[model samples]
Target: MFIYASPSVERMYGATVDEVVERPIQDSMTPESFQKALQVFAEEMALEQTGAADPMRTRTIELEEYKKDGTAFWVESTLSFVRDARGKAVGVLGVSRDISKRKAAEAEKERLARINRQLQRSDSLARMAAAIAHHFNNQLQVVVGGLELAMNQVPENAKVFATLRKIREASRKASDISRTMLTYLGQISGARCAIDLCGVCKNSLPQLLASAPKTVSFETDFPQEGPVVLADGEMVRNMLANLVINAWEASGEGAGVIRIAVDTVEPAQIDSRHRFPVDWYPDDTRYGCMIVEDHGCGVIEADIEKLFEPFYTTKLMGRGMGLPALLGILRAYGGCITVGTALNQGSVFRVYLPVFQGKPSDTMPHPVSMMQQYPKNIGVLLIDDEDMVRDIAEMMLKRLGYEVIKARGGKEGIELFERHHQSIDVVISDLTMPGMNGWETLAGLRAVDPQVVVILSSGYDEAHVMEAGGPIDPPSAFLGKPYRLQDLSRCMQDVLGRFQKPSECPGDRLQNALQEMPDGAFHKNSAEGT
Candidate 1:
């Protein structure tokens, strides 16, 4: 079928309908009176579809059309598909008209609106920071001055040392305020596993409440059934510490109550939109939610929308990082967070985290020691790039009654191993380093003595690491960073116990190999000539 238009042709393209027969339609939409038409087209196209929509269905779009002289104007387009005798879509037809001046005016207005919002947010931050700085700075000054005075007055032998200790502790806490701000930005990275949430809470509450003003009372509602999250224990502990502590401060002095609820948040209650890019984790096990609530005055209505934006605050002043940091941590784990508050009531911050799927156990799985009793003279070579890690490991191993030798890098480690290949019981090395890595060092050690036992240690994710080529075999052992003192002690003793002087080949095997030599092999290959 064919279609046609008349007056729209002459006004839009400066040509009669005759010119449009073999010409483009974009050139036929420059008419001046189509401003109203553009609005209607925008409304229709706003119903954006996902994936492909059905054919023969109507679709509308907005575009700019050019006249013969290249003078262009905006247009509203209504499009419909043409079909074949077999009922398949063959082509599309469209009708459009001009709206150039309106488009120009709207572009200018949007530019101004965006600038206005940025200015307002910046202005709010400046005002908030000024109001809060004095109180924080004042507290810091007093803690520091008090410590100075105590240092002069308190005698070394006096029992009032306890009070001085408290003052020093308070100063250190004030120091941590800056560090905690970093935690709020989700900059902290560490390992996490399924651990007792209640236990971490109880152990951490004292720190949360310590700096809190006396007027605020803290309480918890943790169920015995256990609320668990798959996360680094210390990192989660730090996250809850920041949120709970912020709630205490928000309560303002001692007049408010902070309540923490730790229970499994039901899957049905969560709006899935909060977790964007939701395609990755289709299972509900991705996160566990924690709610931190306060019974102090609620937040202002106008401020709620911008609450989690970085550096936005309603208080006298703050790093404005608390909520933003919590959101960051959740996002890293493919999770979400939000806040709810009403003026004169209180605010509740909800945190959702991915679940940890670890070995099913009530208590942490403790690696059983392979060596129970042994003489203490065995020595081990410890190789790592970090001086602190190497020093501490060497000291710990030495204290466990074994002599410890230290190497700073892969080259040095190999040198020491080759020098004392027979004496060194086992080699411990960091996997990622300059010059060469753990795998290379292991190969160097094996070249000197194939029986050399090597263990790899690092902060890297175990699953993502590649052995590449070293030792010509899988690692004898691997330990993640921040491993326990006991675990290190046991690992050394166990690995050392497994090491033995290379034994002579079994008599039978040696004899069989000798018999299989070329001359003897000729005898076997020819049989007994019988």
Candidate 2:
């Protein structure tokens, strides 16, 4: 069709005005755009014929238009129909400008907002998990401690002894579940030290292989001595175990080979797929990487983002804490994870831990012996908000041959310790209380006597308590809740052994006294001991 074309046609469509006028307008646009233009034109023509509105009224729309060389760009076009002197519709006129930059900016803003929302959700979930685990640990401590005491009182040949043992085992399993919840919240108790990924993975391989079915095998690629990261050794092994186990399960009924690898990876090489903890982003230049890849039925795209969510699993009988806890451990170590998968193809999980550049800390804790005995005249100030916990702990301390002074809260403990600072050799205080908490109590006790032995106890792990941040004065030692009699004994002995002179220590006194007293004297009840 012949029509007058503006000289600006060359600038917009990469064609001269004369050339554009010789061809249909569709040539300057993609087929989809041309079809859209036709629809708008038909609507305007119908309105003009019926006199439903002004014929020259303009309408604006954004569409993709093509240049003569076939490159496409977005344009906002204001279109109107030109009318003749008789008020009849004639030709159409349109003005369009590129809006690509504006579109990109809008998209970027939306993406940032979405990420902020995700971080908020992650924080909320972590808080809820921590609260649940903390309360559960507190109650489990009472049950576990009480069971151990009762079992000790009954003879091994008694009928009730076996039942009590079974109950204690069940309580221990429950304790493990509570620990997993804390791990998912990144509140696990473990020391972080510089460790090589290769050594950890290699050392744990035998156990991992034994746990998997014989049909599933491993293919490992590891560097000999490199790729060290600052993290907890046991937690690292746990993370690797979770990944390997998941890979094995994903391999399905057929025989499969799970590939495990460790090496140094540049930040730029990391694939953007599923990320753990939702809020983490890569910040390190180089990272120690562990890769676990499975060739069996891969994960679908829909389930990828949800893989690290607690209790979210595709399997029918899965508890779903393994991946979430793994993510928690990595998050605490200043690391991140990436996943790549395709349905029916395969899956690759890459764990990236920050490479340690400084000198590694080699200090390790000394194990306390379970047979440690307490002194005759020593006094312990036990502080806790729970009546049952206080009562059970008091009985245990008295049975262990230490005089007990019970305080219902931290404030009471501080006041009592001040009154009996010389008599109270050790202060065992619960970390979480109604007011003045364990940290405040520790500071208070230090004010009275700087050298006083204080053991901060919590249902949460020691690492979590330290991470919460308190006064400059740290406790002499930490004891996690739900501890057995042996755990309590070791904690007390360890702190006393480390801080006190050997002659003044209860353990030292017990060794000398054992020659005179009977074998069961230490295990007697508080009334019997008095």
Candidate 3:
């Protein structure tokens, strides 16, 4: 046996086959994998002794193995037995197959599964986008209106400034999250540019700190420069936000510390295939990294391998969207994220973004949409189950020089609209509620006036609203829940503008039709890509 394996086994184990042959098989296997194989062998032995015709008894446990030089690969395997000699097993025979191809296939299968999971997350985002529209829009209106209202009363030196600062910070968070959600869903496209590595980290700290649980302490260590990466500012922020929030949540309300750092690395050529921590490669470059380390209860050994998988969260409340969404955005930009952890010590998530030549922007676009049109004061009827939201919207619209109407439910909203639909130019309603939700309320409103401008908002859809061939109604406007006032106003203006303008004959529309009509090269790519 040793002579037959002398050359190859020597190459694989950094030892002569003669040396390896004398050692017990246990010495040749990794502790964990060895134990598992031993258990399988025991089961196989039992089945054979019972005269059971089991195919699994013939199965061999192949494993990827590493030599002392650190090069690694797959090996086929089998087992030997011990017994008395009347053809009664005195010893056993061991056989193994070189299974590199099978190992490669397994890895490829894993990669494809990861990608499919990520694609599946597109629906989660669509759900969140549609679901939070109303909530987000109204929240933004409050935040923006609050700041606008406080702008008059707040002074730079006042003692109340500290408290005001919190409100502003929270409002900023509210607006940013709403916009960030949209950005994740690709509802909005972002400017692509190169950005500073540490600068993005520093700016992100403030928000990350704001979101952490009160008990969790945070720290940062970022060098001024090493490498810069081309990335979408909003997308990067979203990824960082999710990671930071995850760390906090894992840290358990307030028992742990989360530390983040930035560094640059260049891995060996062999690491390229596995380089992506998130496995969703952005663009093809290889340059930058953002290291997010959390000292929360570390991930279990079993869960570590599946950490980046979509919908695979260790947290009880985790919908598992955050990390996967983070991965999607990074992948779109030609980057990848990775996770590493030791039990009880916590996890370190490393985000690798290929650095490029261009310079990154210092300031991100403000969460507020920069509308070209100066907004005109228009009457808005606000309907929501929550009071803080209603009061908030009421104060905001009134301050904007528009009369406002408020209602607690869809029914009340319909009543108010019935009494004043002529004067009410816009109806802002939430979709998910106990009764008379936004969709139901809009149906009632449309019955009153098919011409009445309507904005539908919701936090989620019970049905597959975005599925291909899903029924689509021609609502005049849609504002996703959690939209800022700017988004709400944008939808309202868009819908109203569409109603006022002529369609199907505009020069731009005509130009688009001409451009899209029989463009062969562009056509081929779309068909092949999807």
Pick the lDDT winner: 2
Put down candidate 3 lDDT per residue, 1-530, tens digits, no spaces.
Answer: 23235467775678776777676656566666668777876776676677644433346677655555655667887765544644344444557656778888988898789756645665665686645754675656556655655654679688877787777678777665555454444443345677787877788888777767779888888897757777667667777878888887777765778888888776432134333443343444455778778887887866764565546776665467677567546645556666677787888888877777766566555443345343343456778787776666565455444445667898887876776565556777766666765667777888787877766664322122222113435456555544445555566556555554333232333233334333321111122121
Cα deviation of 253 in candidate 2 (Å)? 2.5
Q: Which stretches of candidate 1 lie over 4 Å from their true place?
A: 1-214, 217-238, 263-287, 295-334, 341-345, 355-360, 364-377, 385-408, 411-422, 439-452, 455-491, 494-530
**What ranking of all candidate models by TM-score puts the best one first?**
2, 3, 1
Let me know the TM-score candidate 2 reaches against the reference structure: 0.81
The TM-score of candidate 3 is 0.52
TM per model?
A: 0.45, 0.81, 0.52
Q: Which stretches of candidate 2 lie over 4 Å from their true place?
A: 1-96, 271-274, 300-302, 358-365, 501-525, 528-530
Per-residue lDDT tens digits of candidate 2, residues 317-349? 557889989988877777888888888888889
Give the clash count for model 3: 32
**Shift of residue 7 alpha carbon in model 3, Å:** 8.3
What is the C-alpha RMSD, rounded to one decimal, of candidate 2?
5.9
- Model 1, residue 243: C-alpha shift (Å): 1.9
Top-TM-score candidate index: 2
Candidate 1 or 2, higher lDDT? 2
What candidate 3 gets wrong by more than 4 Å, as runs, is 1-17, 32-74, 77-85, 117-181, 186-195, 203-219, 225-242, 248-257, 264-279, 282-286, 301-325, 328-334, 353-530
Question: Model 3 RMSD to the real structure?
Answer: 13.9
